[model samples]
Target: MRDGIPRFVPEDNYGKSFGYQWNLHRLTQLDSYVGLPVSRDRLLRESGWTTDELEGREVLECGSGAGRFTEVLCQTGAAVTSFDISNAVEANATSNGRFAGLRLLQASIYDLPLMDESFDYLVCLGVIQHTPDVERAFKTIFRYLRPGGKFCIDVYAAIVAYPHLRQLLRPVTKRIPPGKLYGVVQSITPRLLPVSTRLSAVPWVGDYLTRLVPVANHRHLGLSDTETVRTWSVLDTFDWLSPQFERPQPRRRLERWCRDLRLSEFEIERIRGLYVVRGTK
Candidate 1:
């Protein structure tokens, strides 16, 4: 098992509970990236690729935090295997149980316990950078995908963003607890106002009421609803804590990597602040 919080999936033998709020309603709201202009339900529409592209194909998704997209992939006739490092996703498994073809496995990207060349389509989004090593993780995932299979992914690009600016605030921000720190950050950041943030936005109220708060300006810009706000509050804080910008692989660089791995036909779509790289093995 990978070294991390006690909630690490591989170490959790029971899988009875993951002690996190990860329901379908909550997950669909936390995100708006990947397949831009398209919601998670509109995956094929936005990416210009559909599950019909690989009818009845075996699929795999790494870092299936809440299996929101996993549900969509399975609905499209793909056999989907979703994996994550946290037992916290046990709730995700339960929530997604309606999809019989969907499978939830507890594992990490660096040490995926799967038979080589077992999948025809692979997806690892919003992950990789948080791992011990990115290259190693990519190589490991590549081994599981069969030749001619496609891999679609979205990750933080190296481009500079004010969110990264949160790092500078971390010095003072870190002094407080994670929950409280997130709240303070949320208040100053106006984007978090309309919707209520769960973990990150909760503690700020206490601090604000008691006058222990620090700063507030960042707005809750993207997330529209309360559930979306909470999920974003928890996740964005996690991103701020472990921001890893890994992207913009020159087409040649990515092409060579794909070639070495027997993956072909590389294409990249640049979204507002990130990149969605799609290629075939």
Candidate 2:
């Protein structure tokens, strides 16, 4: 660590877009806003783990942007090692710092600081797809799990058409400065939100129409508050638009990774354009 702060080679940090976006919406996705811990629910559903399964477990949560899911993991009474490749971990630290079962680190998935076979469970959500190399990232994360240790990962589905538009727009949008791109998304999100909501209601063709738009439509994500929706709309849209790399991977590819690594009892499924993979080492 340089000057008492972790210093990564500039090339390894590919999450400046995420850092910019999450700092503003640090607590927006947490359960405190609504009576439901939706983030927690998503984790449990994706990993096929019950509440009791997480208690006292040692979990390594990679790409823990803004600590949304970090809070959920900590709430499970588990010792969580959360890391992100951006300054967003600062927001994570501020919000979840008081928890005794938490350890926060700012590190890239490709080059994490932890030792091999050091964790009981490894979770990398909303992350692998955004990495420069999905397969390599998967291999690297797999090295952290102990023999028979379990892991759950979620990434954008490679076959999904929604991401095609983002890929089309990213060449130009990603070139724009983070602040400027954020400004562009912030101003247009409110207007596009209503358009997205209206078009999403058009019967048979609504979902496709909504997907055609470049903005993220959270209408069907089970989110309920207006302000929360609006905030998430902007943040998630910027998320889709601003990433340097956003390659969605297919279930087959994930299964291939598991097979190549000789992982046992692995399961891969797609849910709402996201591929969820759970496996045992």
Candidate 3:
């Protein structure tokens, strides 16, 4: 183990963008850092698993960027084994290394080192769509879940047929180095935020107008202030443009995967912009 964490993947990979961004914005999405239960609420809502139910259970967390959900899972008293295909594992360790129940690793979903049918529960959030092969990644991780184990995951929803402004610019933005891409997003967010913020209030067309710009503004989401909104905007916008892959799955597709896998009591629904699929093995 290197730096007190197991390393299963190379230091550089397709997830380099995530490693870069999450390390820079290490605590940006943490519930504790934000003084809000944003991560906690989402974890509970999407997984439909309470802390009491998960206490002392084994949970395998994939794509644990900066340990936002790791903190929440560890607090549940679960034996949480979390991994990512990037150096974001370092950031996760920095943020949540103190948690006794947490075990951090740098590993790929397709090649996890753990045994099959080992975990009591599994959760992969804000990650599937970013993988090179979403379906195969899901199947690979699902193999490790024990029978009757609960699993939860979320992917970008393929709801819109037309490309948004972010999609239109991804060809150029994604090619730019992450550092340069972050700089560009940071520079543009301040100028366009007011315009997007203003348009977001214009009733029907307001949301559409805001989408035309590439920057992400979260004023309507009720952040503390404009600066917080800007910070989130820059971070999210970079996230949108810097990923090596950004695939969105349709609701039916998610349903088919669940059915094909024979996952019982599965529910596939759009929650807060992601297609959340949860079920039992």
Best by TM-score: 3
What tens-digit string does per-residue lDDT give for candidate 1 at 1-281?
Answer: 32222233445332111223243234433233322222453355335567576558898888776665676776677788788775645656655667778777666666666899999888877666555565666678888888887787665555423334454654554345444544555455345333322323566453233112222212334434544444455555543442233233333444455567665686766654445678776
Q: What is each predicted model's overall lDDT from 0 to 1?
A: 0.55, 0.83, 0.89
TM-score per candidate, chains pooled:
0.67, 0.94, 0.96
lDDT for 116 (candidate 2): 92
Per-residue lDDT, model 1, residue 280, is 75
- lDDT by residue for model 3 over 72-178, one digit each (tens)? 99998999999999999999999999999898889999998999999999999999899999999988899999999999999988865135788988888888999
Candidates 1 and 2, the one with greater lDDT: 2
- Candidate 3: C-alpha RMSD to true structure equals 1.3
* Ranked candidates, highest TM-score first: 3, 2, 1
Model 2's alpha-carbon lDDT is: 0.83
Can you give the lDDT of residue 225 in candidate 3?
62
Instruction: Tell me the tens digit of each residue's lDDT in model 2 across 101-138.
Output: 99887788888878999888999899988889989998
**Model 2 misplaced stretches (Cα beyond 4 Å):** 1-12, 161-164
